[model samples]
Target: MPKIKDKAIIIGVDAVLPALLAQGVSPHFITSIDPQKLTYEKIADSADQIKDVSLIAAPYVTPEVHKIFPASNIFWTFSTKSIESWINSMLEGKILTSGASTCAHLNLTAAIMMGCSPIIYIGQDLAFPEYRDHAAGVVLSDPDQIKKELGVTNQNTVWLDGVSGGKVPSTRGFLSMRNHLEHIMASNPGPHYINATEGGAHIAGTEVLPLQEVIDRYCSETIEFPSRLHTALQDSNLSNTKKLLSGLNKALNDTKSLSKTVNKYDKLIHSILHYIRSENNNGAARSVSDLPILLQNKISNAESLEKKMDNRKHLYIWQILGEGTMEDVKKSECSLHEITILAKQPENFMLSFTKNLERLLSLNKARKNILAMFQHRLLHIINFHRKEKIILKKIEQKKNMEQNLFELAQFYFETGNLVLAQPVLEKLLALNPDSAEVLFYSGAIAARQSKFEESEGYFQKAQEADTAMSKRVLEFRRGLGGIYFDLAGIQEDKIYSNLSRKMLFKGIRYCSNHPKIKQEIIYLAESDLTRIKSALESGTINDVETILTVWHKGLEENKNLAPCITDDQIAGFHRHYGELLLKKGDLDGALKSMQAALKFTPDNPDLYATAAELFFAMQDFTNGITHLNKAVELDRSYAILWENMGDHLLQTGEINDAIAAYEQGFIAIPENINLLKKIGDCYLENGQLEAAREAYKIVKEKYELAQPPRT
Candidate 1:
């Protein structure tokens, strides 16, 4: 990486910043995309090394990222549909690309957009090559590692093409990410991408060359680019600066005015709600007609204000606080036409809409504050500096208002009013996108709504952001695990099972310091594994995929949990697979299952007996007798095995052999009446009248002796 800094324009993600900084390779631009504090903390921890580097952060990044870095060097990445991108397209400056979700994907997008030739990918090892997540200098915490390792069980862990040609362990996330990068490479075939990690998972679309070889082949000459890069940046960026400055100035004022109006609407909605439900009905005896008319007028005013916030100036707040009144109206009604029946709706919808308005205003205020921060950094670099002093003075800012909105949101969230709290948190996220408290609540809300993956991401970010909330976060995680656990118990849904097991796995990991909690969570997880295994064995759940999935998960989970799962238990799961296949009448599948089971326990008589059963189901009487003979040899006293061998022989017309097998069965169990009857049947079939008569007479006497008396 250091070798290519001088030869090529180096760009990377937030995760690589520490590695880049440690090696003294100042990236031209280090971009951030995840709304994770750990993502921002990596940048914060490398503050000293990042002075000369520009930061191109997405709008979803935390405000702390915006604080330490200057706005002049901090370019924001926006969606192509965004007004900022539209303005950039019209202006003479750097136009950023909206890559696929990951930072490395974004780096590729940027590299492709810049017309860079032979773009090389380094530090993109999407696998645990050495049983480690990343190379040196990347500080991945324990909790997140537990979470990532959730699905990568011993049974299901993916083995992909290794950089040095052997297979390596990887998770689904890394595989998906690699797929995305490969797709980008495949779609845009112009620039050649080189994967020079030389270890970890191999990428399909990249040239697998070592770093030194890449340098020798393409970077033999040291090209001077720093000056040209800075020159090109300065040449065509002045026009966009003024337009942005003017928009910021106007946006600051708009938020203050917008906030007061939303607050007013909040009070009115409560008043109207109270009146609508009141027995006296505002003491006016008013019909429904008058109220709907009043509501329509209020709705129009609120819609007008919301529409005003939906423009270019308020893009951050508008985009962040999505699902405005229109979404609310739709959710409140069954159809578009029923949106007109707003008056007939419950107060919850009204409160939700008003909450949306209030939080939108809160987001507007947050935007106001953020714009001031932007103006503080950008004011010095602008042509509008002559008007900057007055403009900065007129940036009507009250910091506590944002906090008050957060408090309001917290109250609603805590009281189980997610509809009201959701918009508020969305607003707060746009304000302080990575606050540990806000992120935790956001995750909690997502969990309640069954957005398990999104919830996990938020919880992980919250855990990474603040160590102070460690205990609370741990408790919350247990609660989340319990939710999945309960759902898994009641419904055999694969989604719930996967989620529960993963969270329980994380619980076992994160609560490692808390021995009691760790014990409890592991027991819960282990119990669930047993539960699924029991279900499979009982033939209650017969879906082949479900059976196999549970089988794999149980092995992995039990292995991870102090090797609680025994060889017998694992063999049982495998044997149950054969049992399920047998139950489904899949003779070939059941045979294959028994064959696999025998690999684990070749000496176990039960597996051979199972193979004999499958052979009987397959109607191969010869192999069936052979497998039963093997079972009897392994366990001479297994009466069922002896009896089964006699039955198979008799069915194949080997009467003498059948009679001898029945004698062996009677020897195995001396009080066996069934074997005596089988011997009589075999003797009779062989036309030996005296032997058949004697065997039948003995069988009749024993059968009569074993019979119960009539009541």
Candidate 2:
């Protein structure tokens, strides 16, 4: 490889990128981290227009992006040293250290590895300059929308050194990046670091210079830049392909061993469950005496397998195969650790041990699926390079390959490549026409493509094939209901809407014990209720009793199925149900329902407010005052709660407490015109004429400001 002694520009996609492009700095190479940003039509067009500016990218660039910018070069910055060493051995290149989390760190490492002297940084603006987070011509989210979504305001600002030496607004993310860069520059003493970004947070050890000046000083003469990128690509392809195949073979062997271990654990779980069941009929003391021994044996077997699979080679195999990240591997290990800890607890040993066994079984299943998918992809890669059609034929002819095909199709579906996944599912269906799992995925793909009729047919077929009442079947039922809901939305037909409601009710009846399925059912019910309310308001429909009956039935089924449903959820259901009863003029029924909701969730401020409203409707002013006081005490920041408390206090003849409540309300909502008027009224009623006049003046100014200007 050629050594890069001249200055190189590490182009980050920060807001200052356009500035550097405008300055016409022709560096030897442009090291880009975010390929999606770089491959934006305008940015790519600009880069293509500039000759001899090679684009080097990080390895995490997705396949779609590679298709967009095929000419760009990629370098491996693996997080683990083993993968790095493996890849470097194959490619015969020096392994460069990956910058710890961010792509900017990787870019810096790349520049240092190239032995670039006087490296110039452009578009490294770690802070938002003038509230602009990205450069012109780069597609980004609206800053105002981001602020609103995150519930942030302009007041949440961090200070950074401005372009001209004063402090400017920055974010914590920018400051951390700046600190990392400064530390890197400080540790490496040979190269002179220069920040060419005209506006951004300042680095302590780098000289700040304009891009034009840096270009004039560094690019005084045209020098020949050598080409080694093509050779590097060829070497990487040949060497990495072999290494990937090797890793896949080892992973396949490990997965087989892990599968056997998991099967053994499954048998142990079944034995334990059987013993527990029989112990209920027979004597329990003998079973209880043997429980610890069974638990210890199971735990020991699981721990042995866990240690065997926890080696660096197996742990990093996913990253080496280009299938997952280091973070993903770490997360899997953390989950295992937590499950192990849960199993070790003394109290509730059976429940904890069973939970751990279930989690381990699930993890093993996922690992097996991943291993199969990796094998398929590796074969595809090998065929691509060697120009052979052997693996494809083997996949087609192999018997009992349903699991592998299903996993591969599921992977493609998740990665948003339905085009590739559809044919695989079709083949799986042909092999096993009555497989519920295959039919369900077929329906899901159809639904995603907006072919609701075809999706409905597939879902109905899956439901028929699923005679065992398995979890897959229940989820398919939910999917079928969602399809009907979508069809109703598109056609606005009453028949489809009723079908949607009926199917959702059926699915919830069978799977109300599942937390995820229960949540989905609740979301569907709430959405339908909103639609019903809108129709009633517009005189489009008036059968409120039928809709309420369906909703009540679903909630009742959920309550019967599991005690794990949270108290907060039950309270919310009762509160909404009570409000609906009030709308129907059943005052006594509404009051009872609201009181029951409060019993479940006494600390909930919103529920208290609802109870207050219910009491006030019954002409029980004293009870209403009590609930309103509780509401305000629970949440002082809620302006509406404080306002309601003031209203009730004034009714009870506590004028001083009312004034204090209104004042607190004003503090929570300083710009509320109604709150200001209420405060003024309280002051006027208390004989504070001067205070009332001041409040009225402020309200008047606010009202005038709200009015339109004269033309």
Candidate 3:
């Protein structure tokens, strides 16, 4: 018999006993210490190995008092905190022994005392997320090297990754201890260490094994194979087990059941694989779907072969035994005894089947590890996004209120309410002085009130103070030039008109120099040019090609400019693109563009109406009805959506739904004579004679009241 070389050392708090005994650790040499108590009685009851224990009456024990003779094979020294210190002192006399330390420093001292090599650490899970109390495993020591080695230590306490449930060490205490240990290891660097368990983090001189391998070898090895087999048989994923049982059940339930025949086994496999796919796909796991078709095809081919190999003896043999047979037995003697040798192929089938099952288990284990890593990382991303949203919302609310204040100031200025306007403008300027619209309005008010000095000062300040305006200064100059033109028309002054024209030309030149600012300025220039066309020649203005060039320039500024474009503007641009396509008689392109527009502007009534119109033009009545319904749902205030809804229903030959739509449209815009007439027509079309008469009577009375009374 081979010699059993396996041995172990135990070191921990009170919870280490279960792990020690399970690993077949001997009871005669184990020692435990109790620092919380003053006498040996407190610990002796808890120490499983001891028959009796005695406490030293004094603070320290001498070598003679400890009964340390040269012949002593095992020294079971019992002390609490001072054990490592005493061992270190004894090392000066060249005496070597194995013992555990109370802390990292003490652990180091004990190692030096023993001159130990290759420390195998276990049960050091101090930083584990939950209180483990103990690991259900043991650390084995080699008996041959027992005299040359020191005791193992449990030095795991603080953790770095808090999300993984690792404990955070106190900065003043464990961190300082950790730093000191690192310094010592850096300076000395001799004793090798390996972590036999993985719950704790790596300290200065240890490296951990692959965690699952450790769990399997240590934690799971205690579970008997029979117990694991029983659990596996019960698992839902093992469909072959279920199918085999079910077939047997059916065969027993009905003796003549078709499922019992060798031909039906292929059907059983096909049915089982289909069922497995359904169950696997119900979750998002694609790994389950990756089963090799060769296994399934083999089962099918075997079933066909079983059907062909027919004789009364063959049938009887198949009924008694399952799907395997030897070639010699099948070809030669049709004897039952020879058929037993054919059962060898079942082992090969079982091997392939078991391989798949093991693959699934391995995949499940990998999936669990991946999920753990994601759970830690995703928590931080979600937290950051939440904070960003909160900050953005606060900025938007403040911006909206400030915008409303600017609008109110404009209303007051336009109504010649100078006193009321002055205070509001001053307050707005304090908040956002660079707002050109506010400055322009203020300057216009000053000029109108004959405050020449104030107006000049305001215009000059507006020109200098406007940051956004400087980018498009020519546009503002053109606006001021238009104002000058209007003033000249009122006063009949050629000088003012010529000065305005000069200003317009100057503004256009300045804007042309900065092509980046040309798009918005050109759009404004187009509108202004139409207003001043009578005073200037047509060729004096830039062509449409020039304006398009400016548009292209603006587009080139940023390829990924979605966030920079305001949400409403993006929606409007898509809607315009769709409308342009529709106007060009490209209905398919229009529909696609409209759909893209709707993705951004789902609530825009005008875009929905245009999409409905395009769909209607394409003779897609069902789609037309759907978009019109969406349009009305988005904004009930739109009389046009209801009218469109009525028109589509009428076209589709649903008179009642049409009448209802027209009536709804009339209710919203009662002042519309055209809508009132349409409601009457809708009533007439629906064959509601009395309703149509009443609608006409209302319209006729309104028409008569609006006419002259002198007749």
Candidate 4:
């Protein structure tokens, strides 16, 4: 292996990073995918050991992990999510796609993308051999190190054909990983795939040999990989730095920033939680349809935010960070029944949704911070490419220097480099304290930095300095409004609410031409305001559920007054309410609501799914399957729904229909290999011995690929 250490561009996933570093093998690149902070904690002890290794990361990677790596060293890795194609056009970095879920698969993917040949898999055990999960250097968490929790039993276990000729015990997860590796090898031609781990389950489509022997044959000569890669990266970063800087700057400068999406979705999830809690009150509102109106922004507003990005869906970032919220937003509001039935799972669904949103909120906020870090680093990179004579010498005059430095401060401020922009803006204020642009920027900077009093003074001064600076003053006031607004959400204090309203009203009054800062949205915010002020004036009560209830009620009541609300949105509200009512056992209410919804737009798929499950649970198989068929006709990708249909059919002596539904379920979700066994059982029950035998055979082969527990 030492003979060609320089020849290969070895890459390791975060799983194998510690072991590799311990072995003194400095891999050129590392891959990371898991979103949990645990993914970062796993190899954090070795942060110093791998500062130079490039990170190939998905946007879902925990922000902590991104922070540990050098800003210039990190590159994007994706899980094949449908990111808006325009995202690639904005960055010059080479985007790498990682296979789903496993460390080894991602490593292999990273290697192949780097033009590596004869891909050798080392310690690639698709089985937990001898009940040992990892090699000597790796320290696993306590739960992961335990065996029985994996549900591996002798009866449940399937044996795999091993590399050294004996059978190996394996599990469903490792078996899936093995198949994924095989698929990659099959699809990508010209890479000589070799498995160097002489123990563990055998991988098809690869030659198996001992590591030493494979190295002896393949590593006869050395090639300079480090300098080659370093040179290539230098060229890429230099060419792309300035262009990417502009995009990053614009994103941070956005008022309808990604934060708006976060605020909207956070409210939606909270509104759902509140609605579930309010159901017992018997009088939360006559408008139980508040949910869908609250839900309207999850899709429409998010798409609006994306379109506002130069009128394009530029926020593929949401696809990465805000998975739960984005998934809801991606679906049509009326069809989002995935979490609609809260009456059955109020606590569980609320906890899961809130936790997921919390993670997404952290990740989204983290991305902005990450982009700021990237922006700061890119500025440094751009400086390296600057022609000193052209850039510095020409701006040497006092006046010219002030203008140039002010522009430079604006760049820094726009991309959220407040720390750097602080000193520059201070210098500009020193040069021209009365400059409205400079004062307005100072006010914004102070507001974001939480110096609210100082920010207020700066905004007042800026306004006084130039009576014509209404738009900038309006924006400055809005910034102040946002800070107070957030504080109000956290503390639920009337002081913060009043202050927020004061700033928002000031913004609206100063720039009446700005269409978005309407009295309706302000009143909507008032509906969200405390019992003291907004509640006193608008008669909208303040409490968790009532605050949200009135908020949507305001949106609905002002539909004719506000451009944002419409008739279709109101219908979507009824659909969601009916969908939940079906689950809640209010059949008459559901039928009325459903009919109202159908009148606006007939044959809603979510309505069909809700009714189908309701009927299935009530033992009305004939009607259940009929509704299931209609739902499946509208959307065939719902595997669990298909399984529900199959289970109902199997229970009612419809063997043929049962088998067909199970097959469709299997087609919809190929990950659950156990579905094949269910199909086999149905075939056997129907006395089709040969068909059962074939289906069971395939299931057995896959099931046997891993041990019960991955040691």
Per-model C-alpha RMSD: 17.3, 21.5, 39.3, 32.6
- Give the backbone clash total of model 3: 3
Which digits, one per residue and each the tens of the lDDT, describe model 2 over residues 201-308?
A: 777888899888887777555344435545654565344455565654565566555445545655655565565555543332332344556645755665676666
Q: Itemize residue pairs with steric clashes in candidate 3.
A: 7-141, 8-141, 326-342
Candidate 1 per-residue lDDT over residues 6-72, each given as its tens digit: 8888887876777787897878878777764335445544653454577777766765455433322
TM-score of 2: 0.45
Best by TM-score: 2
- Candidate with the larger TM-score of 3 and 4: 4
Runs in model 4 with CA error above 4 Å? Answer: 1-4, 48-52, 69-72, 82-87, 94-99, 141-144, 150-158, 237-239, 248-323, 326-711
The deviation in Å at residue 638 for candidate 4 is: 74
* Residue-by-residue lDDT tens digits, candidate 3, 1-711: 001112222222223433545455422222323242212221212333322122211223222212211111223332322333332233222233232333334344344434454444454533422332235332111121221121233243334532124543322344455555556556556766556655554465655654444444444323233343346446724224334334334333333332234324444444544554555332322232344475456545645644644445344323332212234334333433233343245533333443443333343333334333433333443443354445446546776766667766765555445445666788888988877777766665554333434655666676787655543444544554443333223232322222232222322332233332333234333443343342234432222222222322233332323333455554544444454456567899778767866777678877777788788778897887678767767776666777877888889888887877787677666666666677788788878889889989999988888789985
TM-scores of all candidate predictions against the true structure: 0.44, 0.45, 0.20, 0.41
The clash count of every prediction, one per candidate, is: 0, 1, 3, 9
lDDT of each: 0.63, 0.59, 0.45, 0.60
The pairs that clash in candidate 2 are 15-135
Cα lDDT tens digits, model 4, 144-249, are 2334434555454567889999888777777878989988888887788999986999999999888888777877666666677678877765435557556645
Which candidate has the top score in lDDT? 1
Worst lDDT window (10 residues) for model 3? 1-10
Q: Cα lDDT of model 1 overall?
A: 0.63
C-alpha root-mean-square deviation, candidate 3 = 39.3
lDDT at 507, model 2: 38
